[model samples]
Target chain A: MPQRQGSLDQAPTGVPLTIVRLDESDLSLKLMEMGCLPGEKLEILHRASGGDPLAIKVMEYVLGLRAREAAAVWVSWGDTPLRNLWNSQEP
Target chain B: MSLQRIFLAGNPNSGKSTLFNALTGLHHKTANFPGVTVESLQTEIELRSTGKVVLVDLPGTYSLYPQSQDEWVACQALVQAASEGIPTVVVVVVDASNLNRSLLLIHQIQELGLSMQVVLNKCDRVANPGLKGVVQWFENEMKIKALVCDARKGQGLNEVSKAFGQRLAEARSGAVSTVPGPWAASWNEVFGQGLETQNLGNEVIRAQHSAETVERYRRINQSLKTCPLHETKAKAALPNGPDRLLLHPVGGILVFVAVMALMFQALFAWASYPMDFIENMMLWAGENLRQFLEPRYPAMSHLVTKGLMPGIGGVLVFVPQIFLLFLFLVLLEESGYMARVSYLMDRNLKRIGLNGKSIVPMLGGFACAVPAIAATRNIVSWKERLSTIMILPLMSCSARLPVYALLIQFAVPEGYILGIFSLQGLTMMGLYLMGVVAAVLSALVMKFWIREKGPSYFMLEIPAYQWPVSRNLWQVPLRYCLSFVQGAGKVIVVVSLLLWFLASFGPDHKMSETLTGQATPPVLEKSYAGVLGKALEPVIMPLGFDWKIGIALVTSFAAREVFVGTMATIYGLEGDPNQDGTQLRLKERMQKDTVGGSKEPLFNRATVWSLLVFYAFALQCMSTVAATKQETRSWKWPLIQLLYLSALAYLASLAVYQWSL
Candidate 1:
C-alpha cells in the first residue's frame, strides 16, 4: 500500500507519524536540532484550545509547536509500525 | 592565584541552572552582560583539586547560532571568551534520558574547538544500565569526560566538580581544545575551516544552520547506533496525568483563572495586615518625633516629620504587597506550571503581537510594573516584549488600589447593588476592569505600528511538573524585593522629598508669611506647589479639576497613592482639622469645599469620576518610568509612554466629566 502523507498539523492525534521533510529551512533547522529528524517517529499529543499550538511528543520529549510551524513539517504513516528510533533499538 | 573560568551551557529545560546553583550554592552574583538585560550568574567554586574556579551559568540556548536575546547573549559570551583567549572550560549540561538529541549541542560546542565536558543532569529519571552506556560513549567516541548527576536531588555533584577540576587543570597546563572528532572535520569541510566571524545574511546563516543541524543529527544517530544503549528501558518521565487537566482546552483556562483568583485573594487578604501595621508604625514614629522636635527646631521638625517620614513610609508600605505578589510569581515560575500557562495563552496573545511568555509579566504588572517590565526579558520577539512593557503600566497596579479606594469612597454612596454587592465596591471593580479593557485595546492598537524585530516563533518546552525546590521558593522573591527596594525605592524617596519641598515653600517670602499667619501647615495659595497648580488649572479645567486637585495631581507624579495624602494636606491647611488624621474629617472638608468663585460643591459626581478616571490611566509612578528606561536601555520608550498615557488620561477624563455633566 502507498503510505499516507500530510503536514504534521493535519496528522491525527495519538497516531505515530514519521517525519518526511520540513518545508522551511529556518524551521527545519530548529526542528532538526531539537531532534525532530526525518524518519523520527512522533505523535501529536494535544491541540491547544484555540487549535493553533499543538503539543507533539518526539525524542522522548514533548514540544509545543504552533500550527504554522507544524505545517512546515511533512510527516507520513508507513505500512509497517515504525518503532520510535530514540526509544527502541536501532535497525 | 588567577581564577579559572568554567562556562555552563545547555538547551532550555536541561536543568543546567539547577546544577549551577547546586554546585555554587547561594554565593553566586547575577550580573547583566555589559549592555544587555540578559543576566549572567557566576560564582567561585572551590574544586577539590583546582582550589578556586569561577563557574559561570550561560543563558540556555538550543544552538550556538542564536535566535533570541538570551540565546545571542549566550552565544556571544562563549565566542567572545574564546576569542579573548580566556582559559575557559565549557561544561555542557545534557538531559541524560534524551541523550541522542543532547549530543547535537555537544557536537556544536566541540566543533567550536572549545575544551568541553558533559554533565548528564536528570539522570535519576534514566535507567542505570543505559545511562552507563551513554557515559562510556561520551568518554570514548566524543573523547570528553562525562559525569552522571541528578542535579535536582544534589546527587553525584562531586563527580561533576572533579571532572571540571581536571578539565580546567588541563587547560591551565596549555593543553587546550576538545578532542577533534570526525564530525568536526566534516563540519569544517562544510562551513569553512576555522570558527572565524562571518558576516552573512540571516537567510543564508539560517540555511547553513539548517544544513549543519541535519548533518549533526545524522552523526549523532550514527554514534548512538555504535553505543550500547537501551533508551526505551528509561521510565517515562512525562507528567501526563497532571498535564491532561492542566492543558485541557477548557479546563486549563479555568484552572488558570482559579489560580489567579487565589493569588489575588492571598495578595489582598493576607498582605493587608502587614500593610496596616507598617502604616500605623510610621504614623506613631512620626507623631513621637514631631513632639520631640516641634519645640526646639520647628523647621527641622516640619522637614523630618512631614517630608522624610511620609516619603519613606510611602515606599516601605507597599513592600508587603510586592513581596506577596513575587512569592506567588516565583512559585508559579519555579514550578513547571508557568510554561503550560504560556502554551495556553499563546494563540490569544499572538493576535495582539505578544508571545505566550508575555502573560507572566502582564500578570506581574498587577502587583508592580517595575518587576513586571524586568520580567519581559524572557519574551523572544522584540516587538512583543516592547509592547508588553508599554502596556504594563496600564494594568491597575497595587499603588492605584488606594487611589481608587479613596476616590470611590468619596464619590459613590454606600448602597447595595441588586441587594447584594456594595455600590462602592462595584465602582472599584469597574475601575479595575476599565484598566484591563484599556490595556487590551491599547495592545490591539499597538500591533499595527510596532514593527517586528524578527520572525516570531512560539516553540516552547513544557517541562515535567515537579515540587518547587524549597530554597528557590523564598530566595527568588527575596532577590526581586531587594532589587525593587534598592532601585525603585530610591526614586520614590527622592520624588516624595521633592514634592514636599514644592508643597511647603514658595518662590519667595510667601512660605514664612503664610506659616506664621496660619497653623504649622502652610496656606495652599502661597506655596510653590499651589502656584504650579494654578498654572495647571486651565489645562485640567475641561476635566472638572480645580487648583487644589491640580496640586494633588502634581504631587501624585511621585505615586498615584500620594494623591489622597496631598488632598488631606490641602484640605487640612484650608479647612478645619480639629480631629487630626481622621479620614472622616478630610472627607467632610472635601464635601463642604466650594468652587473658587461659586457656591457649587468642589467634588460633585462629575469631578470625582473625572479624577478617578484620570488617576486610572495616568503614568503616575516614576519607578515605572525608570524601570521602562532600564529594561528598554533607552529613554525614548519611557518618554513616549509618558506622553502617550498622559494624553490618554487627559482625554478620557475630559470625556467622563463632560458626559457625567
Candidate 2:
C-alpha cells in the first residue's frame, strides 16, 4: 500500500506507522537498539497531558519518547497490513 | 589452582542481579569499583566439582558501546579483566522473552574472545517450543552453550551451576580459547572501516552501519522461524487495560498526587513509632551508663552518655524513615510503575531541560539527596544530569522533619484551618512546597543561563507491569538501609563526639578559681564550641539567632537531624527546672529559654521562621556533600554547591527575619 512519510509525533494516536528512517542524532542508535529499526511497525499508545511525550509500542514493549525526540524518527503513515509483525515474532 | 573470577554481565532489567543473588545466596558484598561510585557485587561460591570461584556481578548494560556512567564502569571492568592475565569466565544473562535484543550484547561479548556462557533467564515466561528453539539457536548456530533458567523461581539453577562448573574446568585445562576469535576480525572490519572514513557523518557510512545492524536483526528473525514456535497463547493484556485509566491526562495526575501523598504519609506517620522507640532505647542506655560510671569517672561517663550515645542515636533514628522510603521506591520499581511515572513527568520536565527520568531522582531527593544524586545515572544527557544534581539538595529530605517539627511547635500557634485541618500540618506542607518551588526555579535558571553544548535526548522503555517480587521488594530496601548505616554511620559518630568534646571542655583561663570551686561563667560559655559560636554571632545576628543557636547551626552540618540533638545537649547543659536532663523534652526546653539579659523569648516568631528558612535552603549534611563529590567525580561541584546554597540560605533567612520583625 502507498503511504506518506511523516514524523512519528505527527501521526494520530492509535494509528499504526512503519518507521522508515531515523534522523542522525544521539538517540538514533538507542532507538534502533530498542527495536525501532526501519521497516518495523509501531503504534502510538497514548500521549501525556501536554502531548509532548508519546507512548509507543514496538517489539512487544512500550517506549516513551518526547515529541522532539520522536521528530527524529521518520515513519510512514498508513494502516500496516502486517500489524503484528513485531509482536508475532516475540517469543 | 587459584580461584577463578567470573564476570556476570547483561542488559538492564534482564534479571541479571536476580540470577547473581540466586547463585551467591547471601554471600555477597557490594563495593564501588576502584574510584567510581558504580556498585559491583562480588561473591564467593564453591561449586561441587569446580572448587570455589569468585563471581563479580557487573553493572547492566545494553551494549559494549557505553551510554551512561554505569555502563562505562561495566565496560571498563570487563576490558580490564581481559587485559590483565586474570583467569576469568564471562557469563552473559539473556532475557528469554526478548532474545534478539539481549543477543546484541551477547554478540559483543563473544567478539571480546572470552570463554562465555549464556543464561537464558525468565524461561518460564516463554513457550516451551520458543525456549527449545532459543537453546538450539545458541548451541547449534552461534556455537555458544546456553542454559535456560527462571532466576525468579530458582528453576534450572542446578543445571546452570553444573554447566558453569564444567566450562570453568574446560577453560582451566586450556581446551577453550581465551584469545580473540574469528568474530574479532569481522568486528574490526565493521567498526574499523567506519572510523577510517574521513567523512564521519557521511550518508554512505551511516547507511553501511544501518545495513549491518539490519542484517543482524534479519539473521535473528530468520533463526526464530527455523523452529515451530507458535503464537497460540496471547500475551497477558492485564496492564494495558488499567493503563488506559492510569495514563489518562486528568486521572493520571490525580493518581500520581495520591500515590505521593500516601508515600509521604507513611514516611512521617508510620515511621514515627519506630523512631520514638529508638530514641527511648538510646536514652535508657545513656542514663544507665551515667549512673554506673558517674561515681568514679564523671567526665568519662558524661562523654559516653551525653556525647557518644546521643550522636549514634541521632543517626540511627533516621534509619526507619529511610527504610520506609526505599521500601516504597523499590516496590514501585519492581512493579514497573516507576517507568510510567517517568513517562508522565517527561513533558513538564523537558521545559526545564530535564526529562521524565530526572523526576525519579528529584522525588528521591525528598527522602535523601545522597541516593537521589546516585539515581541521576539514568539521565543520558550530560546537561540535564548536571542541572538535576545541582538542584537536588533544595528538596526537603526526611532529616529536616525533626527540625521542622520542633520549630513549628514553638513558632506556629496551634489552630485549626477551616475547622478541619491542623494549621501546623498546613505549615509543614507549605515548607515542603517552598523547597520544590526553589528547586524548579533554580533548574530553570540553569537551563537558560548555563551554557552546555550537547545534543539533548530522552528515551525510556516502559517495561511490562508485573507483580512486585516479594523477595526483591524486601531485599532492595534492606540493602539500602544497610548501606546507609555503613556509609554514613562513621561520619555521624565522629562528628557527634567532636561536638560533645567542644561543648564540654573550655579554656583553662581560671585554673586556680576552678580548683577552689569559685563562681565563674557557665562551662559551656567558655567552651570551644561556645567561643566559636560567639565568633560567628556577628554574621548570624542579622538572622535573629543568638550564640547558642549559632552553635547548633555549626554542629548540624554533620547531618540536618543533628540540629535537634545539638539543641537538646546545649539546653540540657544550661540546667533548667528539670536539671536531671531526662525529664525535659527538647521542645519544652526551647520554649522556656529566653534571650540573655532580656525578658523576650529566644525563639521569637522572627527567629524561628528565619531558622526554618535557613535550614530549608542550606546544604547542611556532610554525607550529601560526599555523595555529590562521588557522583560528579570532582570536588568543584560540591564546593560550588556549598557556597551557592549557603549564600541563598543567608539572604533568604535575612529577608524572612526582617519581614517578621
| Ten contiguous residues minimizing lDDT sum, candidate 2 chain B | B193-202
Question: What is the C-alpha lDDT profile of model 1 across B1-661, one tens digit per residue?
Answer: 4567999998877888777767765564652211112456777878888787888888787876665656766777776665556678999998776777778778778766667889888776555633777778877888888888887778888888888888887777767655554444433332342322222125655666677778778877887787765454432223357777888878888999778766655655567689779778876887788789978878777767666776666666667876777677667866778888998889988998788878777877776777678767656667888899999998888777657655676688878757855676567657766887898888988899776555567887766666666665565556555665665557656665676677777675456654454445445677787888999989999999999899888777877767756665555446354457432334567788788868988888899999999988999988799889987778999999999899999999999999999
Candidate 2 CAPRI grade: acceptable
Clashing pairs in 2: none
| Residue runs of model 2 more than 4 Å from their true location after superposition | A77-79, A82-91, B1-3, B21-38, B41-54, B127-133, B154-164, B177-211, B227-239, B412-427, B509-522, B579-583, B597-599
Per-candidate clashes, comma-separated:
0, 0
- Best by DockQ, which number? 1
User: Which has the greatest TM-score?
Assistant: 2
Superposition TM-score, candidate 1 onto the true structure: 0.83
Clashing pairs in 1: none
Model 1 misses residue B80 by how many Å? 0.8
